[model samples]
Target: MRHSFYCFALFSLLGAAALLGQDKTPPAKLVLKAKTGNVTYDHAAHAKREKNACPVCHPKLFTQDAKAPVAFKPPHKKHEDAKASCGSCHRAGGTAFETKGNCTNSKCHVKATERKG
Candidate 1:
């Protein structure tokens, strides 16, 4: 009985410390699927930049509105398009979210180099 009591106290202290040490900001991005690209919208950064409340992206990308519990992992199973109802053009010819811009240049997520087959 005494051993269990001590264990409980230790667990409580650890839990409190973990909570205190956490950042007030939401930990991660509000990832959404779009036809152009699988968008990893940094919620913390976006909130800071836009100065908006949590509801702006909550219940969807943000965890504050989680209908189901989520962990530090990808939320959806399918690609961005089908999940969000974004048509194929979002990834292709000339809709909106094409990867043609930043991907091709050194700016955004440009690949290191092309390898020959």
Candidate 2:
């Protein structure tokens, strides 16, 4: 009976560790479709920029689920002033670049050309 208890305890500990490890692993990228074009958000790069601190944007600015809406709609000034969504950092004088003149041309939105067969 003692031997069985020890085995069960060890398995429980290992299972807990594995579950904890999964939360630390963020998705590499998330593609958000836009009217102009699709924006490929580099999750790994952003996480690296934040030193892998998940809380920096989780459960507040954004959620852990990628399928959820980003809530970064137009009339961006509203979100920017409120420091919400991507505007939290991409606004003018924010940590990252602003969205004013960076709409297209290798910026956030890039229209892809179709290839003819």
Candidate 3:
């Protein structure tokens, strides 16, 4: 009976450790599609870059739903006037590059190459 109790405690501890490990795991990238292109967002990378400040954007700039509809419609505007879109960051003097004149940059856009038959 004592050996069984020890085994149960060991298993419980292991289970708890596994759960804790998941809490630190990085989140998968979220893809936001636009008429001109798609934006791949690595929440984990951004969180790490921001030192894991979830409250900085949670329920405020962005919601918990990674698939939530962005505040703007597409075609990728040239100006950064939409506060609830990717422009929130990809604007002039923003945390990221400006989307106005830098739309074709590889970091913000993945240009499609011509396909051969």
Candidate 4:
């Protein structure tokens, strides 16, 4: 009985460890609505750029919840000056390109082309 109990306990601990080792998958893309156009955020690409370091943005620059608002509204200089939201990196002289000249041509705000079916 003692040996059987030890084996059961060991297996239970191993099972828990296995489950904990799995990483929570993030969304592939997130479409944010805007008056000018919708922004398609490439989550996978960002994750890859960051080398899958989730803490770089999660619960800090942005939340883990996809449904949450990005809080990046226009007259964007406010957020850019503060280094908040997307402005944290996209600001002038920041890590990513600034949003000024690249608004429509960039991958950020995309005007939807009509689909013919």
The candidate scoring highest on lDDT is 4
Write down the lDDT of every candidate, Cα atoms only.
0.47, 0.88, 0.70, 0.90
Give per-residue CA lDDT, model 1, range 1-117, as digits (tens).
Answer: 999999999999999999999766554665443333444545465567547765544544435642333322222223333433222223444344544344434322333356999
Query: In model 2, what lDDT does residue 50 have?
Result: 95
Kindly give the number of clashing pairs for every candidate.
1, 0, 0, 0
**Model 3 lDDT vs. the true structure?**
0.70
Angstrom error at residue 82, model 1: 9.1
Q: Choose 3 or 4, whichever is better by lDDT.
A: 4
TM-score for all models, in order of appearance: 0.32, 0.80, 0.60, 0.76
The alpha-carbon lDDT assigned to residue 6 of candidate 1 equals 100
Instruction: Please identify which of the two predictions, 3 or 4, would achieve the higher TM-score against the true structure.
Output: 4
**Candidate 2, residue 65: CA error in Å?**
0.8
**Candidate 1 regions off by >4 Å?**
26-56, 62-117
The residue ranges of model 4 lying beyond 4 angstroms of the native Cα positions read: 1-23, 115-117
Candidate 2 structure quality by residue, lDDT tens digits, 1-117: 999999999999999999987765567999899998888899999999999888999988998998889988887788889999999998999999888888786768878899999
